[model samples]
Target: MDHIEGEPCQDIEDCRLTDRHVQTLLNREADELARHFTGTFSPETVRDCVEDSYTHLAATARIRTHLPVLAARFARQRLEATAKNQGATMSDEPEVLFVCVHNAGRSQMAAALLDHHAAGRVTVRSAGSAPADTINPAVIEAMNEIGLDLTKEFPKPLTTEAVQAADVVITMGCGDACPIFPGKRYLDWQLDDPAGKDVDQVRPIRDEIDRRVRTLLDELVPSNA
Candidate 1:
C-alpha cells in the first residue's frame, strides 16, 4: 500500500474532510495562485475562490494528495471563464473540450498543451466520464519539464453543458459517453494512456499531445486571426 502524510481525513471511518482543514489546504496554495491571477484577483479573493473550489471538489474526491493543487487550478479556470464571459472575449475564440476516462492523464495533458500553444486564441476545458481522485504524478512531472503546471489541474466530471458549449470535442479514450450535437466537430485521438506510467513513459504522450494540439489550433485559428 502507498503511504500518505497528513492525510486530510478527519474520521477514518467516514473520511469526510472538514471545512477548517480544507481551508488550511486552500491557505497553503493562495499566494502561489495569486501569481497566476495577478490582475484578476487579490490574494484574499484568490483564497476565497480556492476555498470554494476545494469545498466543491472535496465532496467528490477519493484521494487527498492532489486536492489543494487541483482546487487552485479549478478556481483559476472559473475566474478566467467568468472574466471572459463578462468581457465578451469568449466569442473571439473557439472552445474545445477534451474528455477521457479519468480526466487525469491524457485529457489533462492535451488541454494544457492546447491552452499553452493557443495563448488565449482558444478556450480549453477537460473532463472525465469517471473523474479520478487525483491526477497522475508522472503526468505532472512530464509537464513540469516543459514549464507547464498540472499541479492545479483536477479531474472534473463530464457535463452536457461542456459538450454543448464546445466548438470542437476531442476524445482521447472516452467513447460514447461524450455527447454529440449538431454543428460541432468531433475527433477521437487514439493515444497511449498515461495512467500509472513513469515520467519517461509520459514524455512521449506529452509530446504527441503537443503535436496534435498545434495541428488542431492551425485549423481552428488562422495565424491572421
Candidate 2:
C-alpha cells in the first residue's frame, strides 16, 4: 500500500525524497521492517538498513515511483542475510550465493536454476559486483523458455553480509569484488557474460549454468544419499 501519489520523478535528483510526504512513507517502511525483524534486529538497525537500501537503489533507479517498495524489499533481503550471518536465525539447509559483474545475466540464471533444482533443500541468493538498473531482457527470455520466470527479480548489489551468510559462495565473472572470509567455501565459475547477447546466444549459457547448478545441488543435498 506504500505508494507515491504524484507523477513519477524523471530524475533521481529531481525526486524530493526528503519531503514530508516521502518521509512519512519511509517511516512506515521502517516500522514495518522493524516489526518483521523484532527479535533478531533492533528498530534502529532496521531503519538504518531501510535508509541505506533506499539510498543505494535511488542512485541507480531511473524512476522513483516504486522506490519505497523496492527499498523495503532490498532491506528485507539484507536483514535476512544479516540475521543468518549473526546466527540470529538458524537453518539446516545450506545457503548459496551467486556473484557476477551484472546480476542481470549469469548469476541470475545460476541462482534461479539452483533454486529450482534444490527446491526447499537450499537457500539461494544472487548479487552483482556492479548491478545493472534492470535485468537483461534476453536473459529473462532465455529463462522463460524453460518455464523459469525472472520478471519479478531485480539486480541486487553485492553486500558483505550476503557473502557471510552463505555457506558456499560462487563467483562467476566478478573477479575480486566479493570479500574473502574465513570458514566459507568459494568457487569461481568461468562463464561467459550475457550482457549483449540475444535469447539464442543466452540459451547456451543458460543451459551450461543449469548443468552446473544441478551438479552443485547434488553435492549440496545429494539425492542419492
Candidate 3:
C-alpha cells in the first residue's frame, strides 16, 4: 500500500501526515543531525524535533529517491540537528524493509531483529519478490529462542510500491526479479537461506542477522549521538 501521498497540508487538521500531502511537494528539509543526540528522548520531544528539522531540511537540499518518505530520510540528520538546537521535537522514525527469494527465511529474521533492537524507534517490515505460503518453520523456531513473537506476521508478495515505500531495501540474493529504481540505494546481503535447514543451522543464521541488524540500526539511527 502507498504510505504517503501528495495531499496539501490544510492546517493541523490535515497535518497528521497523509499519503497525498506527504508526497506532493519536495520542500527544503531542515538540517538536523540525529546522530548528535541519542538515548531515548521522549516521543513528544523527538516528534517536535523531526518536524522542525524537516522544515529546515526541506528548505535546504534536494533528496533523490523514488519513494518520497524514503528520500525524506537521507536528509534525516539535517532535521535532527535543527530540532536539537530548538531542544527536541523529533517526529516520525524511518521505515525499513527486508527482501529475499522467499519471505520465509532471511528477510523475516532481519525484519524481526531490527524491530526488536529498535523498540518503536523504527518501523520494520519484510516481504518476498515471490512470497511463500508461510514463514519457514525453522526460522520461526530460532527467533522464538530469543523471545520475539512473529505469530501475527505473515509472508507477503513484493511490489515495487512496497520497495519504493521503504527508506532502505535489503535484498538477500533476490537478483533480477527485483527491479532497481533510480535514486534508491541497494544493499545485497550474501547470507544463506534457512528454509529447509534444521534449528542448529538456522540458529547461526539468526544470530548473524541479529548482529547485522544491530549494527545497521546504530549506523543508520544511533540512539547515542
Give the C-alpha miss distance for residue 3 in model 3, angstroms.
33
TM-score (C-alpha) between model 3 and the true structure: 0.59
Predicted candidate 1 versus true structure: per-residue lDDT over 1-225, tens digit per residue? 222334433333333335467567778788888887787677888788787766556655767667788777777776665555456234767999999998999999999999999999888999999777789999999999999999877788776657776789999888799988899899999999998789999999999999999999999998886
Which portions of model 1 show Cα errors greater than 4 Å? 1-56, 59-90
lDDT by residue for model 3 over 1-225, one digit each (tens)?
Answer: 222233322233333334444435323221222233444344444445455433332322222133234334533433333443354554467667789986888999899989888988886777777666457888888888999876555555565555655667889988877667676557888998897799899998998888889988997787784
- Give per-residue lDDT, candidate 1, residue 1: 25
lDDT for position 95 in model 3? 67
Model 3 worst lDDT window (10 residues)? 26-35
- lDDT (10s digit) by residue, model 2, range 68-150: 77888989999999888777898999999999997999999999999988878999999999887789999999999999999
Count of clashing residue pairs in every prediction: 0, 0, 44
TM-scores for all predictions: 0.69, 0.90, 0.59
Each model's C-alpha lDDT? 0.80, 0.86, 0.63
- Report the poorest 10 consecutive residues by lDDT, candidate 1: 1-10
- The C-alpha stretches of model 3 lying farther than 4 A from their native spots are 1-91
Output the number of the TM-score-best candidate.
2
Using lDDT as the yardstick, the better of models 2 and 3 is 2
Model 2's TM-score against the true structure: 0.90
